[model samples]
Target: MRILVVEDDAGIALGLRTNLQQRGYAVDVCASLASAWAALSSEPFDLVLLDLGLADGDGGDLLLRLRQARAAAPGALPDPLTPVLIMTARDQVADRISGLNLGADDYLVKPFDLDELEARMRALLRRAAGRAHPLLVHGELVVDPAARTVLRAGEAVELAPREFALLLLLLESRGRVLSRQQLEARLYNWQDAVGSNAVEVHVHHLRRKLGEGLIQTLRGVGYFIPREDGA
Candidate 1:
């Protein structure tokens, strides 16, 4: 799954990112609310790890803006099922209650264990899925998560292994910026340098077979899959 870590502290953000990466998640780290907003605007993500204290703005306002963004969209791209896990140093009951009221799916106080955080995220994802997996859908596409096959509009779409891998990467990230270097690394080994046109080639094929505007290119940065309306 894709997870966004909105935190200002380098240590905490790195720790969370490393831990989550080890747990088979693709993580994007941002230090300020503005960066976080940029990330959110460009990509789709499965979950968010939001910190109350950010360098650019308050987490409360950020949360409100996120909700407004979703509401403004035609069908709320990320949908209400997308989880937002709040991480804060404040542990007061009022703070927890207020965050929950504001739409946070779960809360974690500072000085917590990474295992606990992972456990909480697993629980949230399970609940979000209605306790099921396989046959993942995004917009008009249906992905057989188990078979690694893709179908769009009821027609089977042939995808290269690399294309399928990249698509799954984007789906797992479903609402976050994925740097080209990051995507390239997934396709190439550590010792091999990814060719300039390799990722573009795979993406081009995927798009031609899938549909135009299926995967959006973020100029100067990377790629993202916009959340579908009502998803």
Candidate 2:
């Protein structure tokens, strides 16, 4: 999914952007609240990874602004329950409660692993998607989350853990546009589970096995799987 990453630390921001990108997310980084607001205004993002201590202002204010904007322009917005994952150095119980109260979907303490962040993100999105471990089906392509089976054209398509996770995300939202951030969230627990070109590598292999048209890449956005009728 499209993600806006609001962070001030250059190294941390770069690391996040790079890692998320490698995992098949379209990530935009902003070092300050002002830029965060601008990015939020300019384009539609499925989720956000916001750092509280931004250079321009508190991330809470940014969250408030987003809520206010959504309220003001309800019809213009895409996803009403846009997930926001808070990133903060404060790990106190009160701090976590405060962020959640301020409309943050979840919070992560600093020095946390990217994998953990991704898992939390997946949980948030899964809630927004209104399903927990939902099964995905597209024609002969069936992905059973519980069974961990992938079948294309009625033939079983073998996938590694990461590959299965990636396919699950695509099939979960079949016919919907899923930016890389959303996919990255599925791989949160397994950092070394993939290489730099992991998403691309997996997608290539998936297309080869499932058929070239199964997963279509949206230029400058991400990937998707259309329903059988559309195909």
Among these predictions, the greatest TM-score belongs to 2
- Where does model 2 exceed 4 Å of error? 71-80, 142-231
Query: lDDT by residue for model 2 over 84-168, one digit each (tens)?
Result: 9999999999999999988888889999998788778767766776777655667777676545688777788877766776776
| Model 2 lDDT on a 0 to 1 scale | 0.75
What is the C-alpha lDDT profile of model 1 across 111-202, one tens digit per residue?
89987888787677656655565457887899874455788998888787678868877876677778887686444432345687888888
lDDT of 1 at 113: 91
TM-score of 1: 0.58
Clashes of each: 8, 6
List per-candidate RMSD values in Å. Answer: 8.8, 7.0
